[model samples]
Target: MALPTASLLAPGRVVPPAPLPAAEVARAAAPFGQSTMLPRGAYQDDQVLAWEREHLLDGWVCVGRSTEIAPKGMRAESIGRSGVLLVRDADGALRAFENACRHRGHELLPCGGSSQGTRAIVCPYHAWSYRHDGSMIGAPGFREVPGFDTSLYSLKPVRVEEWHGWVFVDTSGQAPDFGSHIGQLESVVERYDADALVTPVVHEYDVEANWKVIIENYQECYHCPSIHPELCRVSPPDSGDNIELEGNWIGGNMDLRTSAATMSLDGHTEGTVMARLDEVESRTVMYVAVMPNLLISLHPDYIMSHLLTPISPDRTRIRCSWAFPAEVVEREGFDPSYAVDFWDLTNRQDWAACEAVQRGMKTPSYEPGPLAPSEDGVYHFTQLMARAYQGQQA
Candidate 1:
């Protein structure tokens, strides 16, 4: 549950947001035409930013990998307007909580490296120490204060769940079952044995574009023939097809031609063939978009995950990781530069396009344009956004 903002603020200083007029919200959620796009303000408005922080990012969203704060470490991360502390307790279980101190709302830790072997989360402001389980154990001078109760001040928890080693947090604790939300994806990826894949490389990009723009760019291939010459040559533009799925999930497969087995510069498989894939499945590439933050790409030889964190209405930080079979990555002299270079080059190209779109949207005359047949993914994505903002559950 969200904390009471009124109590946290000074007397008579908190101003509640006026409810949006029903007609305006209904218009905002109306389905778009084949040629129409969301209004430009949706990409760069202050109101939209506030709404997203409260409704979208406050729900289950990817923060980082489990290994980053496993066993005995504490890490700080931000999701929308919330500061989160990811902790691995003495019992060896992963947990998450609001980074604010229970007593005075001071940030418990600054952003950066994980603190190793941290036994408790201590607030520098008052030296109030909390065990890994978030129960308050020590509070200097507070023991002498009459009626003070440590039980009433245990750190507030943020609901957390892990999937195949990836960690996600839901600040509102209202998100549906994580497995049920992405079950279709798990069924398809189970064959690849992703749990056995070891991440050997991770890349970060600071994109000057709205988070939705980045996601929309990822869902379509209409620009492939023009912007991604190499990618299209290896996986033809016509090879892209959407996979039918249930719930808020969207995904599809792109066929790599007989001449191309991987997405590298030479279009050849450089790593060991993933076991269990048949001849046809061996050459196919799959893509899945987990709403709000994650974009997953599955290949015959490896897998890539993109986690998008929105910094503002027009800025996003994207972290990309490439994971390969443990056996292959563990091989001596193994180098993933071939696949990394290809994607690194493609990522730059995609970011450039997204940035250009952001610059264009700033024009007062800019308006939504018609979407091509290949942009069906973007259409589906916009629908999801509309529903989310209109107070409909995903």
Candidate 2:
């Protein structure tokens, strides 16, 4: 079925945002070497989070890998205040729709729920059904109405785009085109051939920290020597350069120690190196934080991703996954624990630190602090967020 225009499904109402405190804006706008972190209220206040949900989180937000939903399968996601349903038709085409049923607006699938072999999306409230492509198929007891027409009540469509293997959705339907949003990052990751990779391990964490806190943590490694001993042992904490690229993302690469082969507990890997990586890529790990919600780490042997879902002002849900080449996963006695266990430990340590920051944000004496010289990525992200708070684009 052809999708309906975004206008058909009313655009999200744009509410005027409360202005940020002058001091906060000034702090965020400071030069990198002189800049400080965003104010505590930015991380701890409900109104600040509401502004973010309306502004920063409106664009292309990553939900998960496209591989998670199979043909004739459906997965539900919560994007800002809207619930979206991702469906894979029998023909293998991926589609998305507002999760609500046409009648009474009951949710077709609860957020975070998934169903396999879903031939029809049947609403539990009244059994109204929709095809995989979101066209209305049946509406019980509605045909008797004076002018009831099934064609006029098809489920509303939401914009969904799949880049490589990752699935992104635009709930607001008002953001820039997906290609524009992804920008030059495409050329950078093209060599990875991520679409051909398979994720063998997935970990979920309920972190008691603001979403930005977790992202800021991912963007810097100044704390690696202190918090992530294992990670620091495998990759040098000070050996990397931040790339000034043309994309809606920020990141750089950290060289792996010569003695280490990959990011594993033993600093070695049985897996084969990815096919297209150059010599530099083979020796360094690239960490890219896609604006707002996704973190991508590219290693010689595999790829790791973190998808962030902001639960509230001070809570975020993180889904972490590790992907390896299909051939590597199919090898005899193939085991992912080498990569998984290493990251699981590293991830928990990072989460603990983030939680500490969240708690610290509540302290009455807490205030924005200076960015270290090594925290260039953090400074860039902070500036972008500050512009967002002031209703300006970076």
Q: Residues 169-201, candidate 1: write the lDDT tens digits.
A: 888776666765565667777788776678889
TM-score of each candidate structure, all chains considered together? 0.89, 0.95
User: In candidate 2, where is summed lDDT lowest over 10 consecutive residues?
Assistant: 1-10
Clashes of each: 1, 0
The candidate maximizing TM-score is 2
Best by lDDT: 2
Off by over 4 Å in 2: 1-19
Overlapping backbone residue pairs in candidate 1 total 1
